[model samples]
Each structure stands twice: as C-alpha cells, then as structure tokens.
Target: MAERSTADLALTLTRASRTPLPVQVADGIRALIMSGALAPGDALPSTRFLAQRLSVSRGTIVAAFDQLISEGALLASQGRPTTVHPSLPAHLLQQVSAAAPDPTAASTRRPASPGASTAAAPGRPDPVPAPAPASAPAVDLRPGLPRTTRIGDAAWRSAWRRAAAAPEAETGGLTGLPDLRAGIAEHLRLMRGLPTDPAALLVTAGSRDGLELILHALAATRGTLSIGVETPGYPGLRRVPQVLGHRIVPLGVDGNGLRVDALPTGAAAPDAVIVTPSHQYPLGGSLSLDRRLALLEWARNEDALIIEDDFNSELRYTGAPLPPLSAIDPHGRTVLLGTFSRLLSPDLAVGFVRPTGAALLAELRDVREVLGVRVSATTQHAVAHLLADGTVRRHTRTERLRLGRRREALLAAMLDVPGVRVLPMHGGSDAVIRFDTAGSHRGRAGADPEARAVAACADAGITVGRLSAAWGAESQAAPVDPSPAAAVGGVGGAGIVLGLARPADGAFSAMLPRLASALATVHHTR
Candidate 1:
C-alpha cells in the first residue's frame, strides 16, 4: 500500500499494445489485479498523478477505471482514495468465465457454430435498416444536423482575414485572441440573454470537446459516478460519460423534459447530468420552467453538476429562446456549451463552454494545459469575429426561418405516406420515423438482417438508419434491441435532412419524392 500517486502506480501498468490508451491502461490494471501483483486492500494511484505520469488526459484515466469497474474488476470510494476491492479477483474470474462466445468475433474459436447462437429472441421492436454510405447522399433527410450553406463570401473572407491578422494568444489569458472572447460574450449576452463574462469563457474545438472538458473536471473530485440522460436521447451524449466511466441512468422524458423525480435518490445518483433543455436532442421537447425548477432542485439536493449543451437555441422556428439552464443555475453547477456547428456550419467546429465559474475554469484550464493543448486559438478568434459582426447571428436567425419552412415541407409531404410514422418534434432539424419491415441496415445478426429487406427501400433510392444504436438498450451492458426497422430520421433517414446550406443543393431534390413514396408504400400495405 504505497502512498505514490496514480501516475506512479500506472508505471507498473504499462504495456506496448495497439489498443486505445484508455483500454491499454485498463488492461494493464486488469492483468495486475488478476495476477495479484497488486493485493486486495492496496490503494490505487490518484487519477491526476497517474495521468501526469502516463501523459494522457485524466479523462482517459477515468475511462480506464470505468472499464475496470464495469467488468467488476475495481471499486472506487468517493472523496477517499481508490483501492483494490477485496473481491475483485474472484469477481473478475466469474466475469471471464461467463462471457459468451461471439461467432462474429474475428477470433471465433468456440466449438459451436457462432451462427448457432440465438440471442434469446430480441423482445424489442424488430431491428431497422442498414447504414447508408457516409458519402452517399441524394436527398439527405437525416435529422439532428444543421444547414451551414449560408456562410457568405463576405463573412468568410472577413473571418479568415481576422484569423490571418490576429497574433498568437498570450500564454496566460484564457484561450483565443482578445477580441474573440469579447465578441462571443457580447453576442451571447445580447442574443441568448446570457450574461457571459469574457474571462469565464473558454473556447473549444467543438461541443463534443466542451463536454469532454467539463466531464474531465467533474471526474477528478468524485468516484462511482451516475450521470443522468434522456431515454431516447442523442447516442453521442452517452459516449462522453461512458468513456469517462460514469454509469448513465436513463431519465424518462415526456412533454416537458428529463423527469427530475426519476433521478436516483440518496448518495447513489450521478454527480453530474447533461441536458439539451433549449430543445431536447432527437426528441425535440424543450424543458418547461416547472421541469427546470425541478431539475435545479435535484441538482441542489444531489449536489450534481449540470452540463447544458444548447446547440440549436438560435434555430427555434417557434417560441422565444428560453433562458438556458445554466443562466438560472443559482449554485453555479451548470456548465454551458455553445457550438457554432449547427448555428453557423458543421465545419466551423468552434464551441465555447462557460464553466461553473472562474475557479472551476482554472482547474479545467490546467487540465487542458497538462494534456498539451486540446483546442486551437486561431479558429476561436475567427468565430469571435463571426459573432461580433452579426454574420453568424444574422445567418442563424435567417436559417431558423428557412429550416422552419423545410420542416413544414417535409412534414406536409410525408402526411399521406403509409407505414412511415414520424413523431412530431416541436422544433428540431430531423424526424424519427418508425418503419414496418426491419431493414437490412441493422448489423445485428440475431434479427432478420436480410439484404432483401434493405434492398426493398434502396431500389426506390431511399435511405434510413437502424435504431439499435440511436435508441437506448435495456442496459449499458446490453446492445440496442435488434428488431422492427426504426429508419432513423437523422443523418441517414428515408426522408433526407434536406440541408439547403450544403455545397450539394441538388441532393435534397432527389430525396423528397422517395420519402413521400416510401411513406405511401408503408401506409398502403398497412
């Protein structure tokens, strides 16, 4: 039981492997525990010290620990030092022995034919369609994406000009050129009704990066995390916590938003929660004031941190932009993430996360410094100008009206189509359509993944997404149910996202009728 930091302890855990750093770290630790190189009751290293020694993000270290915990290989105590759980070895043995043989596995060595393994018939809806070629897009009706085709020549040139002219940011001040943060702060203040202090703003490469940064800060001070998420939420939201080793508790959502009453009570609930209150991702339901108050109460009681990722606040076709959850967070628990990707363009990749306050921001800033820089000051500056000149803001407003019209067009077009059922979202870019026959896109083998099923739709030049990954599974331990085709309306859907903002305007034209026809086909047969 040495007093050394986690980094020093990780020295004993290093192995040369092609696996991800997080996985390798987990494997190394797994080997030590399995071999009894580290004894029960022995203390594990601190995450920071280990990350410092291994030269990886604390997030990466957290991911390692998350995996071990998931496999019943490690246990962590809150606020106290991490230790080797007494029964870890015995449990690890049980886990190792109980693993099912994957016939699809590259190294399928089991005696039984892998195909013979019937996964106790998936009780969930029949699995959905196959994946569309990432590059193949005729009329992209895929949802959750934004139109970025309006970055005018004048604004584009000006942004580049500012970026070209701005000097490297000083080593001491918060990221980006001086004017960029100022511009963004002012814009958020005026447009979003957010009183953002320039000093508190830290620009990031993207909203995803911003999430990573906030989660990194939260993980360092806690152990055994449970972060809350919506039931039918963005799959991408779960990745950050899963990677950080936090258990995601599925919070039910209705007309309002995340049901605060469903949050785990006592000391067992999550230390943080990520939400899209402005407009719930995928579901598109905005959190009402009552729910917001309830969420704030839960956060106060649970002492939880709220991560507000408000990407599409500006694109609301209906109603005023509600006050961000972060703005009303009295305890400074909310960390707001604002991204230019959807508002301006996906390629902009500029995002700013306002931390709880200066103190937390400083701690996170140090963490970023330790990771050898996670963002670019240059792009940050360019985005700052876009906000200052009203180019990004004006374009976002204009696009909101445009997307609003398109939403109506797509909705109206699909009104008469058969078998295609879309749940209406109050305001969002994509639709979620439930298809009758499970399409071939679901890579899940147990379900009927016959190519003929997918070809039936493909022949009509329509594409769709399999719902397994998009929707929640029974548990984090379980993959999404592989049944009844759920042709996702986002990214890859039969109804194409129809982004008039892309370089490819002709793509949507081809997709519209096919979507209408597919709907008609599904309805007529029904």
Candidate 2:
C-alpha cells in the first residue's frame, strides 16, 4: 500500500452529532478497515500528524488509537508506525470504493463560516468538522457530577505517565493493585477516620459495580434476596437489585434521612438495604446518630447487611463529618460503597468496596475474578498514584471551596422566590427545593406547577434535577399495601435538586438573577 497524505484520508465528520470527536474518528477508521480501504499491514498516520489534520488535541487522537489497538483491529509496536491487523480477511477489500467518501461532498455542502459558502477555492477539499458543542446551560445544577476542570493538568499528566509505566502482567490479583489498596486504606484512615485493612478493600468500576459484586457473591447463599432502598432515592441504586431479579422494598426518608422504623420484619424483611448516610441524595440530609444506631441494630437483628454509600461525605462545608455506618458497625453488618465519581471525575470510573468481613471480602474477590469484573489496570494505577501523592486530597480541598461558594450563590438566588422551601445542605453539592402552592397568584390551565417550574428552568437554559423521578419503579408499579408495617412512610412530592458544584465561579454570577426570576415565575404560576 502507498503512503497517503492526511488530506487524502477522505474522512467526513459532522459537528452537530451527539457522538464525541474521538469516537467519531475511531468509528470512521474502523469502518474504513472493515471495508478494506486500509489493507492488511497498512500503516496509519502518526497521532500528532492526524491530530493536526483533524484540528483536534493530540490526546483525542491517542484515545482513538488506543481503543483500536485494544480491539486488535490495529497493531501498535514500540518505535514503529501503527498498522492494520495482518490477518484481515480478503473479501472485505472489495467494498473499499463503495465505502469511500463522495468526492463532491465539499462542493455540495455550504461552509460553516460566513461569506465562504459561495467563494470557491478550486480543488480544495472540505475541512473535517469537529463535533458540535452543546449549548451552555445558564446554570447547571445536576447532582453527582463534579467540575473536573478544577484538577491540575500537570498532576493528571504525571499520573497517566506513572500508570503507563506499570507492568502489563500486574493484573492487581483479585482485589486490585496492592499499592492502590494500601493507598485507599490510608486515605480512609486519614480523611474518613475509618481504619481499614488493605486486604479488605476491593477496587471496582464504580459504586454500582461494587454493589453488583456483593450481590453476585451473596446470590448463591441468600437466594434471590429482597432489598430495601430509600424512596425518592438514587434511581441507579434502585435499578440494580431489580435488574438482578430481586424484589425492591421502598423505604422512605424524612429531613433526618431513611425511616428505620418502617423497615419490614419477619419473612418479608429485606436481606440487604442500601443507604446514603453521610449525605442523602436529592434531599441533602444526614442520618441522625440515634437513627443510625437504630438502623444498625435492625441490620444486626434481622441478619441483614447494610450497603452504605458514603457519597459526597468529604465535601462537608458545615459542622463535623458524621461517622459512616461502616465506621460504627461492631457486627460487620455494613459494607461501604465509596466512589471517586462525585469527588473526582466520573470519567475515572474508579470505586472501592469495604466488605463486612475478610471471608465475605474473599468471596467478593472470587466472584469478581470469576466474572472478570475489574477496573482498567491503567485507571487503577493512575488513581493509586493520585491517592499516594496526596494529589486527590489537595484536589478535594480546592473543589470543596469552589462548591461552597457555588452553594452560597444558589441560596442567594432563591432567597426572594416565594412558596419554594429550600432545605439546608450541611454537606454535598446539591440542595432540595420543595414547591408549595398555598398562595400562588399567576395561574396556568391544565399544567402542574412543579412541571411548569422545571420546564421554565430548562427554557431559561438552567439545568436542574427532578427529585420525584428518583423514586424506585417498584414503588410506582406495585399497589399501595397500607396494611404492611413496612409501607413507605413518605409519599413522592414535587421538588428540585440543584447541584452546586457544576457552574464555574465566573458563570455563576451571571446565572443567579436569571435563576431567581425563573423560580419566582414558578411561584407565581403555582
């Protein structure tokens, strides 16, 4: 095969597509390979050269190349140009001409730039367009997402380099890398005041992955267990158990977190229950100490396990951090599910599980190994380096301060809005606003005020989460059995969850007044 210039690649990209630039590039190359535009052993352009030609960052090109290499569609050897797999079948070569981009595409389509639509540049090929950027939200208040730009670029690059240098054969055994586990243990001891044995921690893809592992380990002995999750709780957590063919029991929450008194007893009692203790999702309330002890006792008495999701506990801006259920449990009935998705970037896809016992932990490890459920080796190492070098701690500190400021801005914006009750957020990046219709003045026909409120916010280019949507599907699908002692104590209502960690400091200032007006409109319409 002859070496072709970058311009001769004939790649067409649309900026308006939902697909990311890197994915688009990768898919384009893959299609070419499958259709045999690039033959067996044909070398591809260097990352730097391709990046320049595509007008994208080198990192984007690197990511695409890495994905292809992983799939065996391309071969990457040290100190040599990347080439197509030598074993590619001969029949695919026939489709090359049909798969190639139309040569007249440039002439037919208008250019994006003004005044360039009709100005013909003779024989000049159309420039490859980057993916269209989404319109910016005036204020982004969706919870569980962090502002990853706060992380230092230098530190991030250094961590990746350290990860790349890791031994390819070091699969981290069953749990994960030894250094990573040790780093996680030390982090728990110092930051969370929970001393953990390194061997007790099992690295997972995320908190959900950790939950799945535990369920897999328990399913053989427990046999299709019933699980209890909070009402108006995390939809993600609620879906997992049901997806695994287990029944869901809806437990409700008040201002002080989950109602432990409502937990079922006897044969109907759940085998396991998941709780977000330090900071409850959507509601932004902590579990009271007395209730915490009571809940732990229930777990012990019922012979049930508690899956404590200590999400956003480290971002506390007021008072002291409450001890997690795992930290206080004496009976080892609590398994802690912690993730970097809220604290760091969700892109990392890194989390860990602190199982109830060494035996159970071993079982979980065995299950993970059998199922081949391990986080990326590179990601594990990178996160380990960040944790070991105190980079994560430093980043958390910076992010906390940033989130605190945004919280204040959010409060300031909602001060004048009537009939909307704002809950106090001691920790976490989100706050709940309950909509009341007592003295609403501006009326709308045949529309729910809460729905109108959310729609208005969206129309104003301000994104906010709906609290009512988080209710488990089981609660909605099943009829209300009021006779049961374990029936949910609370009912779903209209409320909004505003995430404080999303907006940049500069963008926040301009968004506040607009948000206030939107809230006011909702109040008036109600």
Candidate 3:
C-alpha cells in the first residue's frame, strides 16, 4: 500500500451541532470505510497527528479509533498505527453501502399519507427507524458545577479498572490512602505552587467536609472559636461554622477580595479567617498582593489561622494565575483547601486539606482518627491514578479551553443588552452580570433588581445564582441602593451569576439568546 497522510481522509466537524466530537469523528470514519474511501488493509494516521490536524483532544481520536476497532472496522496493535480491518468481507461493505440513505434525497422526500403502507417490500428486511433525539436538559447557571461529560473518557475507565484490580487496602486511614495523599501533594505543588508534605495532607469528601473537620478539631481543643468569613461569600462555607456553634464574623470584601485592613482588632478579632483568595466567590476577584501580606500580618498579630479556599483558580481563561495564599504565607498559619469538584466532576467527592503549621497538622490528624476516613478506598485509589498518569492535568486544560469559549459566548450575547454589565475576571467557572438600575424608580425604591433577574431566568427554564444570596443576613438587611451603578465589593450592582460549566457547548450557545432576552426584559420593566 502507498503511504498516505491523514489529510487523505476528508472529515468535516460541526462545532455547533449537539453531537459530541468523538461520536462525530467515529461516524465520519465509519462512513468512509462503508463507501470504500478507506479500503481494507489501509493504514491510518497516528492519533497524535490526527488530533492536531482536527484541532481536537488526543483522547477524542483515541476514542474514535477504539469504537471502530470494537465494531471490526479497524485494527490496532501495541506499537503500530491503526488500519482498516484486512479481513473485512467485501460483501459486508457492499451491503452497508447499499443500505446507506442519501441525506439530500431524504430531505426532499414527501411525507407518506396516513393510510400509506410502511412495510418493507416482499423478501426485504424492514429498515429500523432512527431514534428521536433526546430533549436537552435544563440549563443550570448556578456556580461551582462543571461540564462532567468529559470525565467518562478512556483514562477515567482505565483508572477505575486499575483500582478494582489492586489489592484492597486494610484501611483508608485517618488521612486517606498514602498513595493518594502523595499524589495530591505533587498535584498541589505543580498546579498551585504550594509545596506540601504528604503527611500534612488529609483527604476529605470535599471542601465542605474538610471545613467541618477543621471546625470540629478546633472546637474540641479551643472551644467555640470565632470564624471570620467573607461577606457576600460562599454561603455553604459560612454555614459550616454557624452550624457547629461557632461565631461567624462577616468580613468586608472589595474588588481585590477580602478587606484585610478592615479586619477587627483587639477583643473583636476572629480566631480564624476563611477566604477564597484565588478567585473570590460570586465576584471573581483575585486578592491583591498588599492585602495578602496584610492578611498574613493580621493573622500573626491576632494569633489566628487562615483557611484558604483555593476555588476554581485553575480554570482561568486569560492572564497568569496568582500564587495561592498558602504558597506565600510566611507564618505557617494557612490551611489550604483544594478540591476536584470544579476541575473534574463533583460526583467524585475528592478534596484535600493541607496545613503549613506542624501543630495544626498534628491536631487535624488526631481529629481525623476519631472521625475516621470519609472517602472510600476505591475512590482514593482511582483519584491517585488520575493524578499520577497526568489525566487530571490534561482534563483541566481541556475544560479551561471549553469554559473560556463559553465565557466569551456569554459576554458577546450580553454586551448589547441595555443596562447590563459583565464583570471582568481572569478566570472562573461563573460570570457576574450586573443589572444597572441607576436613575430608575426601581433603584430608588430598593426594588432588588438581582431578585428580579433571577426570577426572569427561572421563568425561562434557566436556574442562575443571585448576588443577594452571597451577603450575610445583616448585609442583606442594611439599607442602601440595591441596584447601584458602582460595583459593590468589586462585584458592582445587583446582578445574576451564571455558571458556564454545566451546559454542553451547543446547548450553552443556544441558551445565551434566551438569557439575554430574560435579562433585557427585567431591565426594561418598571
């Protein structure tokens, strides 16, 4: 056979179609084989070369090849490029060619009458009708969720297979599987630039579980400690300390994240401060260098600890990511909370807590021993494999590209809408759309434009985040212009938060127009 480049195989991809890329590629190849464009025994291009030529992930090409191989259309060996099955019967190819319908002719065909017979001709097998396309699921614009369809790729299955085959460990232990802990440590060092000892890392179900464990450990030793949380912050994190009977201090936040200068001093200082410095929740602001330094200084002077929720910092679309708070802390007073919920899938329920201080680490270990391990041994093993084989990093890169495009689509859709502004951010899974109500009667009456926006989105079958939910009870109660022109805590004005991670690429694009229309309606209303 003559040598042929992958360019010989002409494949067109429809980016706007709801069909997944891998399936599209596979179907394209199958059609080529059935049509005799690729003859039996013909060699195909390497997956790496094909992936680059097609501008898709390598895993996508691998999946397409795997699908074809399973159906006896392609053959692959350990070290050779894939090829069309040499032993494929010529009669089978002819049959497939004869059965394939002409799309153009089908498009122009008239519908049969109600009384028309639908049976195949005598001595012919009846053709099976194609299944109807499934309706798209509801669009969820609430933050923190990610596109999970990509997680079920070959790497994911392979990870689980390895885990199932491995000998079951005697125990997951107080801190989780040793191999998983080591994997997490290396991950943090490479991704977040935070050097961590495997011993200092404790695996938890997620950020919430890690926070609960920390609170319990601290309460057991120090009694009811005051936990400082960012106002208009993650309600889930705030609720953890509140439910544990600890005092919740509402800290002020600006565009640069938490206001370190405004931190209470003397008798009112908090015992620990929980913050999302990488990308502030709801607002999507990075903590300034000056504030980071001041926060560390405040923690030292007050003898407090910093619980850093390094949330969604890795999904940044533009610019370099700032170093995590734990990476720069000088006093060893920071406890870093990391999770795969946003990077991978929330269903994985895997996260890690790493403290810089020796005493704090020891205390957390002791507390975990009493509480026992919350994650299953199999889960830990699977996650450890993902981390070890670079699957997590590759997946993160793919997701970042996907989310960046979604963010751009959102910004473009909302750009022309009157009285709406999309906040600027380096990276995050969600965007804040501020509704401008300046000089309007609703603005003067404290009409809560954010609430109205949320209602409008809900009515359109889209669930979105409300900025008001981020505020503490007291902040929500304070009298002020609910719809101000200036950004509040850097988030600016009343707006709805849209999660960019939940929808499929095609569904997300389709959703943009509806979202814009809903927000426009809310803006023009009295």
Best by TM-score: 3
Over 305-356, each residue of candidate 2 has an lDDT whose tens digit, in order, gives 8899887878866644455677667667778999887777887888999975
Segments in model 1 whose C-alpha atoms lie over 4 Å from true places:
1-137, 169-174, 435-457, 474-510, 524-526
Give the per-residue lDDT digits (tens) of candidate 1, residues 447-511.
33222323444545444443343445523332222323222222222321222333243566556
Q: What lDDT score goes with residue 36 in model 1? A: 35
Tens digit of lDDT per residue, candidate 3, span 342-366? 6787888899998866667777888
- Give me the displacement of residue 241 in model 3, in angstroms: 0.3
Better of 1 and 3 by lDDT: 3
Q: Candidate 3, which segments miss by more than 4 Å at Cα?
A: 1-137, 443-447, 476-486, 489-493
RMSD of each: 22.3, 24.6, 21.9
**Colliding pairs, model 3:** 141-499, 232-470, 487-492, 488-492
lDDT of each: 0.58, 0.70, 0.72
* TM per candidate: 0.65, 0.71, 0.71
Backbone clashes in model 2, listed as residue pairs: 15-132
After aligning candidate 2 to the native by TM-score, how far in Å is the CA of 204 from where it should be? Answer: 0.4
Q: Score residue 65 of candidate 1 by CA lDDT.
A: 89
